[model samples]
Target: MLNRDWHKTYRMPEHPTLDQRVDWHLAHAIACGCREMPDTIKREIEKRGLAVPERNRPN
Candidate 1:
């Protein structure tokens, strides 16, 4: 699960640009185990009632 609250929890890069939210979210998702990401990683993805599984699921 990509911590949606990464902006609050992780140390953001210095001088973040105005149009970098998607990159930020995608990075966070990858860190959390979102391997097969969709075409976009914006608010819509999170708001569309989708889910990202955590790492190491019991198989």
Candidate 2:
């Protein structure tokens, strides 16, 4: 149910669809959460110019 504006915000111009952009970001976010990134995944998101907010999601 993605609307045009939502699509616009999430879509990457270089990518074919918003889903592609979302998939990339989701992987990045997961990397951030993988044992807090420092002890696990490489920190590429900061290089990509993103600062993921450290807010815990409600269960």
Model-by-model lDDT, in order? Answer: 0.48, 0.41
Clashing pairs in 1: none
Cand. 2 Cα-lDDT: 0.41
Off by over 4 Å in 2: 1-13, 32-59
Candidate 1 on 1-59: residue-level lDDT in tens? 33445435654468855335445555565565333444555444556564543332212
Deviation of model 2 at 9, angstroms: 24
- RMSD of model 1 against the true structure: 9.0
Q: Which portions of model 1 show Cα errors greater than 4 Å?
A: 1-10, 13-18, 33-59
Q: List pairs with backbone clashes in candidate 2.
A: none
The alpha-carbon RMSD values of the candidates against the true structure, listed in the order shown, are 9.0, 8.7
Tens digits of per-residue lDDT for model 2, 1-59: 22344445554458436445444455434433222333111344454566644522223
Q: Model 2: which ten-residue window has the lowest total lDDT?
A: 33-42
Cα-lDDT of candidate 1? 0.48
